[model samples]
Target chain A: MGTVEFAGVSKTFGGKTVVQALAEVDLRIGEGEFVALLGPSGCGKSTLLNILAGFEQLTSGSVRFDSRAISNPGPDRGVVFQEASLLPWLTVWDNVVFGPKVQGVARSIYEPKAEAILKIVGLEGFKKALPVQLSGGMRQRVGIARVLVMEPRALLMDEPFGALDAQTRLSMQQLLLDVWQKLKTTVLFVTHDIDEAILLADRVCVMSARPGRISREIPITLPRPRSIDDLTNPAFIQFKAAIMTEMRGAHGAH
Target chain B: MPLAGQLSSSLLAFILPVSLIAFWQLSGTNGVIFGGALPTPDRVWTAWVNWAFGTPTFGLNPYVGTWLQNVIFSAERVAKGFLVAIATGVPLGIAIGWSRLFAKLVDPTIQWLRPVPITAWLPISIAIFGIRDFGAIFLITLGAFYPIVINATQGARAVDKNWIRAAQMMGASQAATLWRVVLPAAMPSIFTGLRIGLGIGWTAVIVAEMVAVKSGLGYVLWDAYYVGRMDIVLADMVSIGLLGYLSDRLIVALSGWLLTWHRLQSFNQ
Candidate 1:
């Protein structure tokens, strides 16, 4: 149900001088497929995700989600920001239930769903705590939980764990893997980290900066039920080596 | 937050005022000062006692036993005006901040009117509503509206873009987003405007009463001065200050309770 397509999409920022953020970027993800846009900073990967999330206007071309042209953000496609961006005034429970509550879902229905999602995200104990009181990783858990509670068809995550410490990031990665393995929601993840892209996605679309475009698309053939332990697997290392080489070549072209 | 600490902090605040009162008293002779033009602290206290508790003797002394009535008059006017300001200003300010079209339509008019001080509006208010409670209220509302609306606009404008996006992504309609997300997020700034607005409300009420209304602390202040009752005038001045201080504390207390999240943020910093 979560098919997405971007056809000849382009975006430009206007000022005294115009800067093209994306130029004729084309991509597609099948239902329940996990795809990551991997690139260095300023590669417009986040811009692409923002456009698909209905938060940005493409200068040209069209984006379709579930065969419908995107007009505005809605519950069908949930976005997890890098900074978590949970409303600071709201507690964990309120943040998780915000989507359903605003969408006018009955309390009888969304309340249990919210409770279950909180438990899944391991934040039932912290449901009453405000966002400011939480650690960065814990806040990101709430971010994921809030989106998941909406039961979205697709998840667009923009470097959801990029701000965490290494150890915290690994745990969060595993948490996401565990959650995604069960839900199998279509995900369009944006990140600059090569290892993260390889570890999580079914296909990695490598992007290059300066009129950002997808330079290469590599399919990860690793078996499912993945874990952090897969990071050391020889097959994962081989994929990483090839991607690193491709990334270097992409960088050299610019 | 300890009891002892809180008590000591409050007591510390009183020391300077107490010493100032003592100095004022000592510098005076026979409860009078400044060649008998000004009354001493003791005289002002005695006047307050009479004004508050003395029996009214059929217009013999208008100031006697009338303190509470005048206080209520002024406070009620301020309250009504401030409420009107909030009712009109908050929504208008939010609209101005949230919608560019609305801002374009209304914001320039408000800005043009803002620099015209409340004192300047008094003649127009008197001309329009002349010598009535509404006249006083109009002045107070005008006085309070600018700060309230400007601050609320700022609060609404400064709302984090991501918060709005998050709400949008959650399937919130534009109205729901403004109410649920923009309103709550703008609260801290709204409180700031309320405080400033209330202060101006007090000033406006005083100005309105002294000129247009026949009763209230401001009327009593000007009347007591005219009748050569320096003690009543001093007491009235002190009464106005006390009322203003109490009302400001009321707003601060309300903001403290409503903005506990904001308080926690500052504490963390």
Candidate 2:
């Protein structure tokens, strides 16, 4: 039910001088596939995700989700922002159930589901705490839990752990890996971290800035049920080296 | 009694006012100052006490014991006006901030009208609503509207884009997004407007009462001035100042409660 296809998509930002952000991008992901767009800042990686999430519109071409053209964001495709972006006024539980509650889902259906997701994210006891009182890691847990409670078919994350400390990032990555492995939701994760792309995604699409375009598509041939510990595996190291090399090549071209 | 440390912090605040009061008292003799052009604080205090608690007389003096009644009249006018301002200004401001088309259609007119002082509108208000309580309330509402609307617009406009996107992705309709997200997010700024608007409300009510209405503190101040009763005028001025301060304090307290999460976020940062 979760498939994303981008066909000849282009985006541009208008200022005194026009700058092309994305140039004729084409990509496709099958149901339940985890694809990471690996690139540096300003590479239009976030822009592409936003376009697919319907937060931004493409200058030309179309985006499809579940074989249907999508023009606006909906509960079916959940986005996890980099800064967590939990409403400062809301408590953990309120933030977690915001999606379902706003969509007018019955309390009977979402309350139990939200509770379970909070438990999965290890935030059961902290549900009453405001987002401001939470650590960055804990806030991101609420971010993930909120989307999960909506039972989205596709998860779109843009560097969800980029703002966290190194230790917190690793823990979050592990948490994400566990959740994704269990749910098998089609995922589009955007990150500049090469190790993150290799450790978490089934496929990595390397991209470059200045008229942002995909540079390479590498399939990760690693075993399932992966954890952050796999960063030490020889196969994982090989994938990281390849992604780093591709990134350097993209930078050199720029 | 307050704790010693608490008293110490507020001690600094009382210095300037207390010193000024002492100087004024000393500058006066027999509770008359500047040859009775201005009554001393003691005279004003006596007048306030009498006006506040004196029995009503069936004589020529209408303000013999009408202080509390006038106060209630003025306060009720300000309250009604400010409520009307909130009812119209907040939603309009949110619309102006949220949608460019709405702003284009309504904002310029508001900005153009905002510069016309409430005193200038006294005649037009009187013409429309007549010399009754509604005229005073209308002027107050008009006076308070500008600050409330401008502040609310600024608040709604300043909401983080990501928050809107988050709400959109969560399947919130346009109405839900405005009510559930934009309204709450804009609350801090709206409260700012409310405080400023309320200050203007007090000003408008006084102006309206002085010219259009025959009651309230403003009427008494002008009446006392004409009738050689400077004591009541000074007392009325103090009453207005007190009311303004108390009303602002009420808004601040409410904002402190409503925006607790926002306060904590800022504190953490």
Candidate 3:
């Protein structure tokens, strides 16, 4: 169980001709809650996520995870990069075991868990295959599996499925829904896709670009154990329409 | 991928070399070419056979049965020099690439010194090391080191930032990240450096032996040329080419074995 808190977080880049990527953004996620930071390109949603992940530092304010200040990226927060970013040299099994091996966890403890996670991700047969050998969706599955094997307190994903085809994207969405339902870990998902945010997150925070800020927070009250089928639900459509109007309003303000 | 395709591809590669050899054989008259200065292919072959098989005549003929010994001497020098290059160049390259302070301290000096050719270093090398095996080895090492270090630095610098971040997020320590992530990520570039370094190593060894040492194929080539044994000179040149080609093939085979994943990766892409 992990909670996140950010207060008055502001970020500026470049020494000359300063670019304010983020502007005093304040947000929080309760333990085990899934929150999507929804926005358009350059909305600083990814920057916000990066600050939380400790990949980048904020110019002001602070970010805390489970009451601890975030300083360096650690196994407690697993990041799924937009490109899936699996080390191409490692086999799937090697990739899954990398975190445990690096952390010096006992093989007796991690081997079975690694195997179990691979099975959950439907990569049991691809344990020996290199990431290059897998399709984009399969590689992303390995990426998720590799992270899940760490049993992190939070999953920080940056546009994880933004590159997939529509069909593969839906299947991945269902997979994530199933996995999230079981794990109940805190997740901070960043995505520009409206349907993705609506379908995945417990709450959607719509953001504005150019001096990025979260302008609205809309709670998703859709039924649990949701899948892609929920994407077509009348309630989902209504929520999507409301969020679209809110997004347009924020876009105009920007 | 099939047997026939493989054979046809190999045959196509050999066409130019085989044609050139036939042309040389046709142009030569009485086992001589260009006013007896150059030996024909058959004469070069006979000289090589005698160099390999002829018994020593109380050390009068340097070429007699000493072919294997000279080849071994040159090969050993290359091996030692290349190993030294790897030992010093790789770590230094990584250090320069990974750290700003180290790069600032060491990189400028390296760049300033690099343009001075290995051949140009021979006089200083002999003066410092004094006409010995280490001098030859030193020259070879210096020659090989530049390419290896530069390539390794480039490789290390070019590693994807996300891989490092991913490793850190997965709980890798700084040393572990360098070893497991940066090193492997830099491997493709490092291998490129190694191939280039090795080619330079061969060139340096030949030049070193030609001047600073009295053994190896390079020494033999110069010695035979001075004595008007153009046959032995031609044989030694061919021998050097053969050794260089074989050594290169060995590196290629090793690269293939080590980089199986990279091959599959680029193929998939």
Candidate 4:
């Protein structure tokens, strides 16, 4: 069974006027597939991600994970928001372990795992620091670590690095790539950045705005174990140029 | 370094009050204002010393050596009332903020009653409790309750949507989400409520003492004033001010200790 399925999904905001944030959307992501939903703002890309994360309900149709209808947010599907959204009162360690702690998992099982995730995210010595004490990029790293500690079946990322500086963004992207390469977990990454879409996903599903729907799906045939240096490759630019043209075409059609 | 700075600031703070006392002493001797109805600084000082240390001579001078007892009475009432307010207010506020139905059911009554000042509640409190500590405590609780509940509601409602989502995604049930996520997130604002509530509680205690009950700093203040012992009255007022200041400092210090993470975040930023 596909890890996630969205069939004829639709969402409306209020009773009087229907927003049609997503309409007649159909998608099936297999287990361990890293799918990037690329679109302009207001394209409902994030809304689709929210639906999959069980943060929002669809007005019609259905969404399923592992053949089970997704009803509410659960440990099986971890979501990373655009903003880091780390609890300001919680230190890095507390935020990371919040998931396991709330789940009532034994401390013995999650403590070392959380410590490992923190180290992987390069926050080994800063566990005691609060979110506000960290830079924007570091905060996002903590956000990722917190989810990873849950060992979630799928990762739903909604512009998770959108607010960072260019340097920080590149490093974060690289970090994500490294983490994903190792885990090979199913990921649904939403972003407006074409280069990011090209760099991260096994397949980029380009979307169109308002009454949002996936307009095109392009596969990335790049070699495995991708690095920051891959951005300089000829294939990378070619992919970017093609996606850019497609995005422009989509924008023109809108 | 910080200790030195604190010492210097406190010393600087005393300068104005000391100069004011000297001026008041000079003016009172010459009957410069109110024909000496306002006591001289030395007289006020002597009265406070006697209130602190004098033996009760047949309890004729009620003001003598009664300062500690009255201070304790008022402080204990405030402490009890404030605790009761917090115990009830916080949970109710969180419920109202978290649930629209609860808000609709309970919020309007709160708003309607909030405008009736604690001072206005004195007659009802006295009638209900018959001039006991309960009467004073009732007024203090009523006075402190509003701010604590309102601020806690604001705090609970202001929790970030993403944080809620994140917690739910982590397998937190509704109750866990509230206790773990909502309460901790709301704590900074709750602390704000507590500080404000404590101040109001002190105010309510004094008001209650002056009218509903007969044994607190406020009662002593009015009694001394009526007896034309302006020095004792001034000393009582000073005592109230000092107590209020000390209690607020205590709350601030508690908040500082508990919210060290929040403080460090802002400081580093």
lDDT, residue B83, candidate 2: 100
lDDT of 4: 0.91
On lDDT, the stronger of 2 and 4 is: 2
User: How big an interface RMSD has model 4?
Assistant: 1.6
Clash tally, candidates in order: 0, 0, 0, 0
Give the alpha carbon lDDT tens digit for every residue of B1-269 in model 1: 99999999999999999998887887776445566667889989999999999998897689889999999999999999999999999999999999999999999999998888889988888899989999999988988899899999999999999999999999999999999889999999999999999999999998899999999999999888898999998999889999999999999999998888889989988
Q: Rank by DockQ, descending?
A: 2, 3, 1, 4
Q: Chain A TM-scores, one per candidate?
A: 0.99, 0.99, 0.99, 0.97
Q: lDDT per residue, candidate 2, B75-185, as tens digits?
A: 999999999999999999999999999999999999998899889999988898888999999999998999999999999999999999999999899999999899999
Which ranges in model 4 have alpha carbons more than 4 Å from their true place? A15-18, B1-16, B265-269
Where model 1 places Cα greater than 4 Å from the true spot, the runs are: B1-6, B30-33
Tens digits of per-residue lDDT for model 1, A1-254: 99999999999999998989999999999999999999999989999999999999899999999889998988999999999989988888899999999898999999999889888888889989999899999999999999999999999999999999999999999999999999999999999988999999999999999999999999999999999999999999999999999999999999
Superposition error at B257 for model 4 (Å)? 1.7
Residue pairs with backbone atoms closer than 3 Å in model 4 (clashes): none
For each candidate, the DockQ is: 0.83, 0.86, 0.83, 0.70
Check candidate 2 and list the clashing pairs: none
Mark the 10 consecutive residues where model 4 chain A has the least summed lDDT. A11-20
What's the C-alpha lDDT at position A223 in model 3? 89
Against the reference, the lDDT scores of all candidates come to 0.93, 0.92, 0.92, 0.91
lDDT of 2 by residue, A1-254 (tens): 89999999899999999989999999999999999999989999999999989999899988999989988999999999999888888889888888888878899999999989999999999989998888999999999998999889899999999999999999999999999999999999999998999899999999999999999999998999999999999999888888888889999998
Per-model TM-score versus the true fold: 0.97, 0.97, 0.98, 0.96
Task: Please list the residue runs of candidate 2 whose C-alpha ends up more than 4 Å from where it truly belongs after superposition.
Answer: B1-3, B30-33
